[model samples]
Target: MATCCFLSSSILRHPSHTTPLQGRLQTRRNFSFFKITAIFWGPKKTTTPTTRSMMDVSLGTFTLIGSPEQKPPVEPKELQQVSISVVSSISNVSSIDWDACAVDANGQGIFNPFLSHAFLSCLEESGCAVQETGWLPQHIIAQDENKNTIGVVPLYLKSHSYGEYVFDHSWADAYYRFGYQYYPKLQSCVPFTPVTGQRILVRDAWYKDQVIDMLISALKDLALKLQVSSLHVTFPTETECQRMKKDGFLQRTGMQYHWKNRNYKNFDDFLMDIKQSKRKNIRQERKKISAQNLTMKRLRGYEIKDKHWDSFYRFYRNTTDSKWGQRYLTRDFFHNMGSKMGDNVLLIVAEEDDKLIAGALNLIGGDTLFGRLWGCLPQAYYPSLHFEACYYQAIEAAIELNLSKVEAGAQGEHKVQRGYMPVATYSCHYIVDEQFRNIISDFLVHETKQMEVVMKMMQDSGPFKDGLE
Candidate 1:
């Protein structure tokens, strides 16, 4: 039976063994309006505690009291009536409802294509993210009083962490050395994607905070019930990372290269903002593409034909095979995305003698262009072809579309010289074992410091002109 739970006058509780809170929640109601007063710490722990409040008339009998910095009160075992059911696939949930929580998570009209139903469904429908591939979808769905879907977390019960860009192989090896099994872990992330966005997908309602709190609690409870070694929410937004930290999830920081647009009129306008040497080098590299009789084409929406997807998949497989990387996505995934997402899908193809030799795949967001995959013909090599198709083309497309930035995937310092700057990406982890948690936490502290220093160095070495930083 489906349960319809309400957050009416109920206390939001963290897991029993989670962190402690040093603040209180107060809710006041006047006729139709409900006012919530939340007194908690800010994102930085060293900052002074503060009180923040808001009033919303639409919320009925629910108010949230905790912020990302404050620990939510642990719900008593008796009040754990909120039911969470894990679906084997994302297709079980209707696209309309899932997208409602995804795109409008904050009511600020922010849209992330990576978290949409169409994208996730494509992974499953195409057999890319399934049990056979080690990414068995166990998505957590939460409903409200009226049986309305308020929150949905894209979770996977994984036997390995091949597709997740956040490396956890060391942790697995540690467990194995100690005679502990760590294969079946819970992961909350987009399969093979490392883009930073909201992991805890919740509707943008007045009771959004309460729903998020419930969702976090549910995730921990589910993790324990399944007896997995840990629960991981990777590539979450920085704000989401902080919120999960309050729920006993250890925060992890990573860095990705992103190109931010500054309202350039054209590609030439952008090149002028970078250093002279970088500008000259980029021009030279781009020249290589044309010099080799290669033609670049940007296809979007219906402009991307069936043959385009077929060629792109071959290119994709070629790149993965050559690098000895796992081919996590299937050919059907591209067709599904193109058919469903339409204009949001951007395919940059490099043609030689009218034959598609290479391609770069990207998804358009509300304000950002996400560069996800790139590959070329295994039989041939074109000097600077990868850079042109992936980085340069993405920047040009973002500028033309008036998008804010382009996230060119993960772990590429090479992108730094091509005008992509380093930006911090976040993730949160909940380890079941106390000993492992402590060890990972200490390691994270050092890793974070190192990452900060490296990011600074990358910023200094960025291609931007002097004073741009």
Candidate 2:
């Protein structure tokens, strides 16, 4: 509800040798919805004191900073660019280039198991993400002068926002009251996935910004031509959000828990790092599983056999059926992803007397591990099995892989006592209805403020040792 702008007193000079666009003048933009800071780049460097500082710039329908006329210089090779279009299917994209672009940005083609071609292909092939199931693929691609593929975005036209983790149901209900349709909004993200990674895939890292800008421009243009409500990019990194903010996108925030290692040599070392009471509690839980004669095996990629996946699927079903009374994925989905992704997928299974009792599945990213799903058969050790299969095994595997952090699934305060620290996650929304946009924007302002306060509070309660030596 409140907005403020401050101008930079000085500006940095750029050298002429480098591309003028890189040196182009930048203007800072601050928004009232939340304290969002954005810097816009122009084609050439300028030193005007007014242009140097981040100031609020507003775009039509959406608000952002800087002149909309500012454009990056077009490359000569792309001058005769071929027309690219958005398709509602990933089956149309060239896999080699798609994987190449994905790897170029994130260092691996697919970070989240749910985003992998195998996983998506299974969803599409299995009719899980089809029109019948409410998930319709809306693939966005960019091409060069020769019509050769240059970039791609794995998108889906979602009917319901379930499995997104980024909640916006209230916004949908408000829109419904005003006779507006919220379903089928353009979404550039992995289906049924909350893990964050590159949503825009660029062939070359050098043209990263260019590729992203082009994607945004293309999506906006497509949204207009197709008469879609808006484009939603969820679970994007801070960098991607900043870029979108510059291009005039709304920002929303939420919190999730993740575990991080500080040179923990083993699980005991990690326990020692937590509060003494928590340490004892966790050890006791592990002892309970041990006393039930249950042991867990950590399997990676190809090591996960069909039988293992089958048992894991059973475990997954048990948990979902008991809790939600339904399951999201089928057994075939697990087999397909395991066969395609190999070692990137991890499965930890608990066995009693050589019989599998529980299992959990996780997806590994460049620096993060994500706990996707877990379940256990009706065993004597189901209580502690959830923690061992879902959290503890994940932490152990993260240490083994030397990953930076482990993101436990959504909305679990219990994870905090188990070494998972609370961190804020983000999602942005743009409502097409004029009145609704204003209403939701106002709501988001309050929500973001509350989330920020909660994040700060959680940080204060972090289990980490306080202080400087």
At residue 375, candidate 1 shows an lDDT of 88
Model 1 TM: 0.83
Output the lDDT of residue 202, model 1.
Answer: 87
Between which residue pairs do clashes occur in model 2?
8-53, 28-54, 28-55, 57-64, 301-342, 301-343, 315-375
Task: Show model 1 residue runs off by greater than 4 Å.
Answer: 1-83
| lDDT of candidate model 2 versus the reference | 0.66
Cα-based lDDT at residue 383, candidate 1: 96
Query: What digit string (tens of lDDT, one per residue) describes model 2 on residues 79-184?
Result: 4333456665667666676676676665444455555566677777766676666667767777764656777777766667776767666555544444446666
Model 1: per-residue Cα lDDT over 1-469, one tens digit each:
2221111111323323222211111111211212122121212211111111111111122334444444554444412233455677788889999999998774677789989999999999999998888887888887654567778899888888788878777677656544557778889999889988899888876557777887888788777767778999999988889989998999988778899899998899999998899999999999999999999999999999999999999988998898946788888888999999999999999999999999999999999999998988888889999999999999999999999999987666789899898888888999987766876786576566656766776788789988885
Leading candidate by TM-score? 1
Clashes per model (N, Cα, C within 3 A) = 5, 7
Question: 51 in model 1: Cα distance from truth in Å?
Answer: 44
By summed lDDT, the worst window of 10 consecutive residues in model 1 runs over 49-58
Which residue runs does candidate 2 get wrong by more than 4 Å? Answer: 1-82, 106-114, 378-381
